[model samples]
Target: MFQKILIANRGEIALRVLRACKELGIQTVVVHSTADADAMHVRLADESVCIGPPPSRDSYLNIHQIVAACEITGADAVHPGYGFLSENAKFADILAAHNITFIGPSGDHIRIMGDKIEAKRTAKRLGIPVVPGSDGAVTEEKEAKRIASEIGYPVIIKASAGGGGRGMKVAHTEADLEVALQTARSEAGAAFGDDAVYIEKYLQKPRHIEVQVFGDGFGRGVHFGERDCSLQRRHQKVWEEANSPALNAEERSRIGSICATAIADLGYSGAGTIEFLYENGEFYFIEMNTRLQVEHPVTEAITGIDLVHEQIRVASGGGLSVKQEDIKFNGHAIECRINAEDPRTFTPSPGTITHFHTPGGLGIRVDSGVYSGYRIPPYYDSLIGKLIVHGRNRVECMMRLRRALDEFVVDGIKTTLPLFRDLVGNADIANGDYDIHWLEKYLAKEE
Candidate 1:
């Protein structure tokens, strides 16, 4: 076991990791930017290091500073809690070169899964279902047209190295393909410094479902279950729940087993998520997140697994503590991303939190890092916290969430609480009759 672990991130996730380390009796060193000197994670860490100034490029994303902090703190391992450099293959390699364990997958795995094109190919090679589209990057216009035609009209062009809905465009017909292709390439080049783009058959209405997988670096792995993250805005997940309202027990077992078997065969280590688009009872692989996901709490809520603790254990060569059959899925869980933003406009809200009060009760959990006087830094993400709830069934879970939302309060700044309150009351959301495009359409209808 590692005596001390350095957290190379910020906000609620940093605090989330810190709490996990504390539970395992591991001392923690939290690295923060100047803008987060007073952040909750820093305040609660056993030791804290100021990495650099506010800008992410100079601070949270600085490799040298993070390595230096580890050296200074004598930490033997580093846990990057999603975002920033969590999925960066070079970062993982650097840590390995320094003989410091990275509490995640190996660099090779990260490199392979980080690339969207390579990930799809890998998924197909592993017998995982994939969408019909181009074999690789569609560089030439002629080739793009050929693939789009073969896949039929209504295709989506996506950046090879893109995320957050950037560098993506849809063409409903052959006439729209040229503009869509050119626009996607331009956006890809500007956003990722890579002009590479790929094409896929765009599903009209698909639910975003992802399987949570964990491996021990050996020929053993298990899946906690799946999270239905169809409630999204601009490709950002707004609400997520476990054992998707769309899937049944048999369907869940089939997909979960497939993911677990693949990870076991690949000898993947630590935490990872295999994301897919589900429509008409079929799942098509979209991408793979080689690090912990933002919506992991819902999985944890149902499985009763301490994923962070497992990550540290596997990284330390302890292997998995539970076998595949030993893991149990108990109940339904839901997570609402509580961002500090305008409820209706979705604009960023960063400022002092005058009064902060979190809901508390059975089956309700709020993971946040802010206090009443905490000044949310404008330089970082606007996510202030997450509210996760669990219940014996989906209906009970929804009811509990509604009651909890009514009790959640944060003053002196705008929040998306109102949005969630409204969503909970909506018929579509209540019945779980939504898809990837449902939220966008609902928002448009409201306008």
Candidate 2:
């Protein structure tokens, strides 16, 4: 086991890793930007290092500074919680070169899965079902048109190296394909420094489902089931739940096995997620997230597994302690991303939080990085906390979430509490009839 680990991230996820380290008797060193010097994670860590200024290029995303911090702190391993450099293959290689373990998949695995086009090909080769689309990058407009025609109308043009919906466009017709292709290529180049784009059949009103897989570097891998992340906006997940109501027992088993086999074939290590788009009773692979997801707490609540601890144990050359049959989902769990933004306009509201109150009692868990009087800087993501709740069943989980959201209060900055309050109360969500476009349409109607 590692005596100490450095967390190369920020916000609630950073605190999440810290708490996990404390439970395992591992010392934690948190790296923060100058703007987050007094953040909750910094104060809670055994040691804290200031990397750089507020801008992510000079701070959180600065690989050199984070590696230096790990060296200076003598951390045996580094845990990247979700964003920033979590999926950067070069960063993982740098840590390995320094003899510091990276608590995630191998650099080669990341490099292969980080590129959407390459990942899709790998998945197909592994016999995993993938969305019908271009087999490789579409460099020319004619190729894009050809691929789009074969895949049918309503195809999505996505950047080969993109995530977070940054370099994506949907085309419904041949005339629209040209503009969509050009725009997608330009956006991909600007966002990821890659002008390559690929086409995929777009599933309208699809449900966003992802399977969480963990592997111990020694040829064994297992999945903890799937999370329904259909509740999203602008392709960013807002609410997530485990034991998706849409998936039946057979579907769960099939997808779980597919995800496990795919990662195992890739020689993947550590924690990763295989995301899929489900529509009309069919599931198609979308992409793979090569790190711990932001909404991983929901899976933890249901499985009672400490994923962070598992990541550390795997990095330390330990095999999976639990088997597939041993893995069990005790209940339904839901996680709401509580961001420092307005529910109506969806604009970030960054400032000092005058009053902060979190919900408690049975089934309520809050992962937060800001306390009362903490100033939220404008230079980063607006997420302030995560509110996770568990219950014996989905119905009970929804009710508990409604109550928890009502109980949460943070003054002096706008939050998405009201949005969740309205969402949970909606009949469609209560009936589990909502899809990816449900929230967007609901919000549009509200206008």
Identify the leading candidate in terms of TM-score. 1
Off by over 4 Å in 1: none
How far off is residue 202 in model 1, in Å?
Answer: 0.1
The TM-score obtained by model 2 is 0.98
User: Candidate 2 on 1-447: residue-level lDDT in tens?
Assistant: 999999999999999999999999999999999999898889889999999999999999999999899889899899998889999999999999999998998899998898888899888998778999988999898988888888899999999999788889999999999999999999999998998999999888889999999987777889999999999899999999999999999999998998887777777889999999999888899988989999999999999999888888888888777988999989999999999998988999999999999999999999998989999999988989999999999999999998898899999999999999998989998988989988888999998
Worst 10 residues of 2 by lDDT: 259-268
Work out the TM-score per prediction.
0.99, 0.98
lDDT for 81 (candidate 2): 89
**What is the Cα-based TM-score of model 1?**
0.99
